[model samples]
Target chain A: MSKQAGLPVLEQDEAVCCAPMVREPLGEEAAAELSRMFKALSDPIRLRLLSLIASHEGGEACVCDLIGPFDVSQPTISHHLKVLREAGLVGSERRGTWVYYWVLPEALAKLSALLEIPAVSAKAPA
Target chain B: MSKQAGLPVLEQDEAVCCAPMVREPLGEEAAAELSRMFKALSDPIRLRLLSLIASHEGGEACVCDLIGPFDVSQPTISHHLKVLREAGLVGSERRGTWVYYWVLPEALAKLSALLEIPAVSAKAPA
Candidate 1:
């Protein structure tokens, strides 16, 4: 199947190397890649899950530590974690029966850079 | 009809004041509010549409200027604009027969701030 089948069409290489999102329309390829990442964050449960993991002690959070706060089924929380893991937003490691998650700062930093405005160039004298 | 009918559940007031999305699991109330904003950004077409409108000359763009570059039907573009409008990402003004869109920089700034990392504090190393 074409990669575009389930995704927005884009020129991947062009997307990875382009002006920031504010400066121009994102190329189709770049948009899809970026959109998927955003979509992963489009859900509230997932965003909270990410936050909890990121702020946990030692920069890592255990599933056991996560399940207590939310009333949702444990499986539902796990599903959200899986989505985040696949999006490269979070990393997970299994230790015995528990899984621990930690933020992947670089991935989120890339996403942030897309929206970054360069320090405003020295303003021409008005 | 309840507002939650078509929207994710969230407590609006609490969401507006809270720790960043990365520092804690977004409360269901906060998550819902924040998720809608992110969902508006989850589509590639919408992202490009936002950028195109923001980067246009004088920080405003006309529908006539944007329609030429994409192959999609005008209605499709219009639909995306409506979504962005409702999400408070852009503002539209009618000038004669053409509609112009301008960036709402404060709205986008609010979003960026939600993800911002506070500067690290000065500390003595052990």
Candidate 2:
């Protein structure tokens, strides 16, 4: 009754086994938290501010130092920083004359990790 | 600096050499573009929609397939998909009777790479 035969290919089946490159997608809670972080980065000013702070010497920047790079007013930068801080993407401390802000590595790492999708395989499923 | 003394510590100097862990920050144009992508992912529904598309078999999803999972109306999901498409995070094509969406790996990689903050060194600069 048995002849040589290959395993059935469920190519079009929706419930087929997941390929190696795919994993469980982001859940609602994680998506909510990540979206908050992404929302903070949704503005160019805030994204630049974050990049500047992260790439600056010592990974921290004085509020006084940040103002000169942009055409925006000090109040505007502060508002952007407030958004970043509230989203947990950065931490700040008031020093003598200015507040210093630094990127929160864990937060950045989490966002980075979520966005890092494994490359989809060129080889079809066996 | 003429003496055999250690290199001057420009720790507080704003123009000091870049640390190994840091790179040139994002430029204005890049910031603008990246922010748009981040803005697309700023909503919870959109983020999950993207994840769903990216992780689905063959790395794409039929819009008809996507509408069933969310509590929102088909129009709402369509709206979110439009945002993702406009931001370049996903691409779409129309086939027989439906639009299929797929994540654009390069776009995701760009966002992921930008957010990857190299571990800020615990050691001070030489």
Candidate 3:
């Protein structure tokens, strides 16, 4: 399967190199690409799923392990996981009958860094 | 005017105190609240607008200054600024004929902190 089928293939490299949003204006194309990642994070279900996956034991969880805590159907949980994966927030691998998902630290770090308030501006009076 | 009309008053306190997503599973209510802020950030135009406002001189920009960089109309820029304000990412003030907008450092810090990977997990093998 094409990598883009499951993740933001075209922008992954850019994601690593892009400056924080506070440093300068995000170019039109960069904003479009980054917004897709943020859009996936805009759903409550997806946020909870990503949290669950990220906080899971050893920083990963199998689909079987992920589905039990939520009240939603298994398919619904799977769908949310898919969204997280496609947004590049999480990665998954099929191991026999179960797919294990793990948080993509670099992706999360990129976003975390983007939201960083510059030191000088952060210290400025509001 | 009610604070909720222009910003997420109900969730601002929660945003201030919530733990990083990598530290634990976010509760349903917290996830729902945060999703709204992330939803506001999901648009490309809004992101660019925010970046412009943040990096502008003195860490603030007037609506007049914000409108010139984009291809869209003035009203469109205003709409996006409203979204940013309501998400708590920014605060605005009416000064003369223009509304001045500035990044809310605390709000951005909250989100930056939320995405932070725990030190242990961040150091763990992928």
Candidate 4:
């Protein structure tokens, strides 16, 4: 139930309630759905393998404990964990020959409520 | 002064307090500085030119009122506003002929506190 935990703080204050990303432009279907989730967070080894599977412990982690902390090529860390499990931001299981991965804190809280910014709301108008 | 307004909510609750992006992977100089700011937010024409310079109206916007709402070209919207002002996430002045842009809402609140996820903290252990 994570998509920003079923949103509604006025839909996370209207995920920048249209017309902002520099004052008007994004609408080729919302820039192709926010650039396919920022191109699955445009790498950096998938944001440090999604911060090592959201800081492990039991949140979950395993692809052989995330391949000896990178030097690339375990098929490029299995292609950045298959692009962070196809951008839902991690959630794999497999078990028997290992696969783990967990952190889906509501797709990183819907990409932090789609990069929120009311910017201390009510100031830009004057 | 954006970079999440000079960070501090205990550094935005320790930006997920290290160790989690699927339990460890990000350090090639922190995935090349968070994948060069998520590859300058991996385009969609620079997220609709940073949401039309963060919803214009004084927060800022101009490049001739953002090239009449897209279809590209104007040097590809001035090369996606110079990749959102080199990923500082929008900010330009120039005024001479034109060039305005603004929305640096602390670099989108330091990328919403680096995609924050204390996820109601502590529970992963089991």
Candidate 5:
């Protein structure tokens, strides 16, 4: 979207562009794309599962390595991982007996970049 | 959560800690806290509204300035704004006839910090 909040809505070519949200109003299309990614992170189990995979050794974790810590059932964990994978936050591959998962740096970086409000952007609401 | 995926859960002293998710598995409490913030951002309209307010002149915007760009009813927009405020993503003030809103940089920074997966953390899923 235009920084000036102009009336005309334009197609944003880069949904994952580097500009922080503090830089401009997001285009409807870009917002939808990014919001899906956030929605995947909206659940506690999903968030924890993502962290577990990301922080695991080798920067990845097999489904076998993932099932131990959580109180939830294996199926439930798989569902959350599916949500993360569907949202493009993580990528997974089926390797014979088990599936491996890892956080996609580009996807996480986009969300990180979008949320980083500079100190100068901090102003009182009033 | 412990980096080793130990069975015992510990109290995370800092929910808004600076360490990225890639650094370690997130504690349950921190995941719940952060998931609420992400849930608030899950909606595309809410995401755009936060961006709009953050990018406004003086880093703030009045309700009057916020209603023009979207096709949604004023009440719908207000609902989204309320969600953002409640999630600690934005702060609001009512001065005279209109309410003003601005992004809370600290809250945004926490999310930014959490999601910043280092390039070194990247690995193929397989």
Candidate 6:
């Protein structure tokens, strides 16, 4: 696969973490694991929060940097960030007085792959 | 894009429907739309049901074909299918005494694209 400039090399294992949903039925354990991630993404605020942190400079942002854009309170943003972190979609680190958050590419990639509709499934019924 | 054998052509509009989450923060409307779809996927039973229908013969399956594998009652399975249908992730048709369900590739593709992490965001911090 062609790598994008300035991007970290994806882990080989995670590169193929999930089969396309159309290839076969998901096992119960896999469905449960994936559903937890989807549950975290089920809220609008959380979705935007994830997007903001991911698109921020250096592919990371500080908690302070995140709070200014939304109408919600700091605690609310923090609560949503905590949920994203718990879902393994983002990671955070404290630097002196502030916390920095970044997207976990592997997690996002796994979900993306899981939702891929196989080319075969795109066909109209014969 | 190369077309897949026996698959219906994807609409040009849908082929480019969603920008990657890492490209920019999602707008309120877009986030709300996507979160609704994600909410439908939050349940484990629904996730498996989507997968099973997508992978079944002719890229669709009848209600009778679906009920045998799960331990849940038929009404419960029917309820989950309704949720998936209402979310626009799957479509259904009634012929005689049974209903056949199929995954909507456009919907799945839209969501898959939304979760995609841009390559630039994959880089480790310097």
* The best candidate in terms of lDDT: 6
Judging by TM-score, tell me the better candidate of 3 and 5. 5
Off by over 4 Å in 3: A1-17, A120-123, B1-17, B120-126
**Consecutive 10-residue window with the lowest summed lDDT within model 1 chain A:** A117-126
User: Compared with the true structure, what per-residue lDDT tens digits does model 3 show for residues A19-111?
Assistant: 567877888877887798899999988998888888877888899988887888999988988988889889899999989999999888888
Candidate 2 lDDT over residue span B1-126, tens digit each: 555535433232133222222355667777787789999989999988988887788878899889888899999999999999999888888989989888877566566666666555321253
- Compute the TM-score of each model's chain A versus the native chain A and list the values: 0.77, 0.75, 0.80, 0.30, 0.83, 0.83
Per-residue lDDT, model 5, residue A39, is: 99
Residue range B77-105, candidate 1, lDDT tens digits: 99988888888878888999999887666
| lDDT for each residue of candidate 6 in B1-126, tens digit (9 for 90 to 100) | 575758433332432338788877777877888898999999999999998888887888998988888889999999999999999999999999989999999899989988887664554754
The true-versus-predicted C-alpha distance at residue B107 of model 1, in Å, is 1.9
Q: In candidate 3, residue A106 scores what lDDT?
A: 82
Q: lDDT of model 6 at residue A69?
A: 84
Scored by CA lDDT, what does every candidate get?
0.70, 0.74, 0.81, 0.65, 0.84, 0.84
DockQ of 5: 0.49
Alpha-carbon deviation at B63 in model 3, angstroms: 0.8
Docking class of 3: medium
TM-score of chain A of 2: 0.75
DockQ of each: 0.29, 0.35, 0.50, 0.27, 0.49, 0.51
TM-score of each predicted structure versus truth: 0.77, 0.78, 0.83, 0.32, 0.85, 0.85
Q: Per-residue lDDT of A83-113 in model 4, one digit per residue for the tens?
A: 7788667788897988888777765666555
Residue-level lDDT tens digits of model 4 in B21-69: 4433455675665566667877777776676667656667788888777
RMSD from true fold, candidate 2:
13.1
User: Best by DockQ, which number?
Assistant: 6
Ranking 3 against 4 by DockQ, winner: 3
Residue A119 error for model 4, in Å? 40
